[model samples]
Target chain A: MTWNSWFSHGAPTAGFTGGPSIVSRNNAVCNIYVRGGDNALWQKAFFNGAWHPWGRHNDGAVLASEPALGSMGPNHEHIFVRGTDGAVWSKAWNGAGGWSGWFSHAAPVAGLTGGPAIVSRNNTVCNIYVRGGDNALWQRAFFNGSWHPWGRHNDGAVLASEPALGSMGANHEHVFVRGTDGAVWSKAWNGAGGWSGWFSHGAPAGGMIGGPTIVSRNSGVCNIYVRGTDNALWQKAYFDGSWHAWGRHDDGAVLASEPALGSMGPSHEHVFVRGTDSAVWSKAWSLVPTVILHLKVLTNPTSFTVDQMVASMRDVYASRGINVAVGSRETLDLPLLTDVDVSTCIMGTTTAEQNQLFANRNGVGANHVVAYFVRSTNPPGNGCAAHPAGRPGCVVSSTSSSWTLGHEIGHVLGLPHVSPSDRLMMGNGTWNITNPPPDLIDTERATMDTSPLTVNI
Target chain B: MPVTMRDVRAVLDPDEVDYSAGARLGPEAFDYLLALVRDTDPGLAAKAAYLAGVIRGERSEEVVAAAAASEDALVRVAAASAAALLAPASASRVLNDLVVDQDSGVQKLALRSVPADPSPELRSRVREVSAGAAEPGLRAMADNVLRGLH
Candidate 1:
């Protein structure tokens, strides 16, 4: 049967309790569990363009905790659901391995109140985090064929909500949970260093009333989105070394569900949430370069030549909500500027390389720019040859070659990747590169298509 | 001591009864209320019907059915839902007749009162009534009720 036909038959039943984590795997398979009328865990899976049976499993008792699904190994997957007894139980299926019998693990707490978030970074290791009886954040990891307790369970204020997990590395992961005080808090495990002490980032702008979702862009950066007390969507992000605002709030008609984050491209990520109306809504941002107009004078350069250009660009960007910084060489701060340039500079003799040279001369680097201008009428030969003054009207062309600078800078400021047409920085060569997309600067001057960056707590 | 019928009646103010608390009434307290439905009080039957509509489960079917068949239209509409959940088979006939009831509110409730898992015969009945019903609201409710069956 067609996918649409199959889905129509297995459409969700109203009043089926489901605060469970729904996950889609690499193979395009999605797994979710809803509480059936009998309170048994009812399972439904989407595979081969069809939904499987709404299997009702009694398993000797009712299930109050939400079920979590993650990869067990290559070509295999596992599902964990908490029994009414508050014990963690697991079920698994391997491609040619068939289904395994359910197995129970030690309970995280005697009275499991909320669902557990499970994530697997690799084939053999999986981690599950739960809110404990004392309202603390508790976790258990299945590694080397057995479940290992990380350390003394960390405490969250009161009524800890569901904890979401994001991987930092193969063996490292971070857990985010909402505290009783309505703020979001986090803990991390860095393999050799073990689990870190709990840290509170501060209350989300809207108080956390539901579970939070965490998605990592890379090892050091992650974002968390949660439903506020008013049922609006709120976010917190962790980037570089600091936590950003709990901004990017969206109020919907119904209670919002925990968000799901997916990577759309390098440095581009999208977050999806079930809105109050039960329709899926998403926001994304991709990095893009900010152009700095530095005039080059080969023979004799004018003072503030770079400063005037930076000031103009800053004004233009500020009016649009894009912030720009002027580079200074008085201190060793030049190294910071150099590091950005060296890392962002392209390594090739192609047109892209030439664009990188122009970009470097104009002050646009990986995440920022430092434009340089000379009026000697004698430009450096080869790659550094200056474009004629009246060619495109804008002399130093040191913006990003593929719009990578814009996209990266967009991310640095706080936007997640979005679709090309709606993106502020549609990378060059992939689409038209002559000018920025019309939607590049939203009314707020901030890129509207991308998810706003906030510290993930 | 068990909550007495007098205590239940005392808490239920005629003009402003709490439906949330009414939902927690036990079998004995419910029986006392059911007795009121049969009382000679002028609007007492309608009030009893409204209370019965929100108090779910199987035991309230008899009183709910009596209320659904009451001479008062509002009481009949409120009892239709309780009847549908408690005794779908018996409520089927009244609900079907109410599909074309002159009161739009009664017809609307009748439409929503269909069971989620109705018998095929009842489903066909709903489809036929909804497809041929004159009132747009009733027809829409009939269509929705049919969908719920599936």
Candidate 2:
């Protein structure tokens, strides 16, 4: 979805200093917080389709840096900022009772310079990432019921700018930053796999002028924007699982500082920036196919375990509002089908060739899809999403990409190997594709959402 | 008997096993790595299988044999590497099983592990894998095995 033209919200702000922080408690209520010209927090509310007038917040909160906000859940809001005293502080709002007293989270041993970056996938977990005084990344978390002590990432990266944080699920987190070399870099945590080694995302042609800002449309997508060396907004996105090349926003909204992103769950998102005039401006956009797909899996065990692959598919699909559950897991027991050449299936031989596979495979037609786990598939694939006519399921290799399950199921729903190698239906060797949270493109999502197996929630 | 997570942890740290190569880790370490051939954690079990192959000592061939029988493809992949390192006579039995493995990766490595002067049966098996392997890389590797025939 393309962003709408920038909307200048002069809002009686004679001169806003930093990038604005914005979030939606739900789809209908948007709260945007910023540092007013008086070096204090200012907020404007958007509800029922109109943005309200700006007003002083936190009883004229004295701010030393930009304010960052996260929507824990509908009606639950949390905001964080670096105080003038060099300590990061936090406050909360629960839609009705007004703001809670500001709480200091203390500071990293090396202290910090940029506004604290924050993200939350649910109400119980929130993370605050900041650029330490040493230029390393420091983080503290609010988990379960209390705040945890500050910690530092051991990635050995020296940041040239602040960090941008995003979460795909409750346990997954992705953070991006501009390194001292002026190139964009990222690190990820997949809940089970832990933190990945830092990888480069390339640099804006004009070079990076500010820290990146990111927002996820769902579990399968991440959109990141940074102020470029060219003095305009540049963006790179991981959509439906594939990474898109970096490009400019083209809205002509030149930034005086970095940008901030906010969203109301999937489909609804906004980008706010401090324009050259020091006035807060924002552009909002929405995506399509806000629907849920359901598929139940039946496993046929092999020596290789299916837990990690199954769990990953569940999490990735869950983010896109798809529900996947294992129905009945049993062994295939038949050696012929268990270790057979699947060339005809992957390439579509004929009905008879397809019959060779589905003849003994059971657990069909329960308003969900089925997957047969086999020891292996000949012609060298970890899994085959291919089936003939009425089979409507996939045969998976015992040790395959966790995405192989989803990629194969995507076939039954009318998706093909139609996108990048990082996509769910990547045509090449999927086992080698290390990119996580694979993309399910808009067209593919629309197709999958309309399948007979999907019941809109 | 199946190896539990605790049982494996008691022997040696999983991460540290990768560094055990040529370290002459004592018998306890081999015992732990041996039992791990049946560990429920397939990924870790595969690593144990790899460690057993690279650090072939004190009945390590038994570890390689058990790994070949594992339903997990990764363990079998490690088994191929282990078998490749063993003396030709000792590695033949398991090498034959992996040569026909359903996973192309296992088949490719197993085919490459086949002794320079393969038995008539092994030569025929290499021909079969070269013909049926789905991946081009594996197919090419299998062909290389046939090319090296004396």
Give interface RMSD, every candidate, in order.
Answer: 38.9, 12.2
Off by over 4 Å in 2: A12-14, A58-60, A287-457, B1-150
- Per residue, candidate 2 scores C-alpha lDDT tens digits across A1-457 of 3355799876435456767888777878888788777878888888988988998774656888878888788878888988888999888898688789898988999999778888786778888999999989999988878889999987798988888888888788988988877888899987789899998888777787877778886788788888887778888889756888999877667787788787765766788887777777888776432212223223344443576667777666666656565555555445434433454354354344235765544645544566767544542235666666565666776656567777777777777665365666766545535477777667776787788765432
lDDT of 1 by residue, A426-448 (tens): 32121233344324556324332
Model 2, position B61, has a per-residue lDDT of 76
Candidate 1 chain A lDDT trough over 10 residues, lowest sum:
A374-383
- Model 2 Cα interface RMS deviation (Å): 12.2
Error of 2 at A447 (Å): 22
Give the number of the best model, judged by DockQ.
2
Q: What lDDT score is found at residue A162 in candidate 2?
A: 83
Chain A TM-scores of all predicted models = 0.57, 0.62
Candidate 1, which segments miss by more than 4 Å at Cα? A1-11, A27-62, A148-159, A249-255, A261-272, A278-362, A366-457, B1-150
Clashing pairs in 2: A207-A229, A240-A439, A240-A440, A241-A438, A241-A439, A303-B71, A303-B72, A304-B72, A379-B134
Chain B TM (all candidates): 0.75, 0.77
How displaced is residue A410 in candidate 1, in Å?
A: 22
Cα lDDT of model 2 by residue, B27-132, tens digit: 4456777777788866456656655666656566788788889997767866776677666665777787789888766775587678887777778888887898
Q: Give each prediction's root-mean-square deviation over alpha carbons.
A: 36.0, 22.7
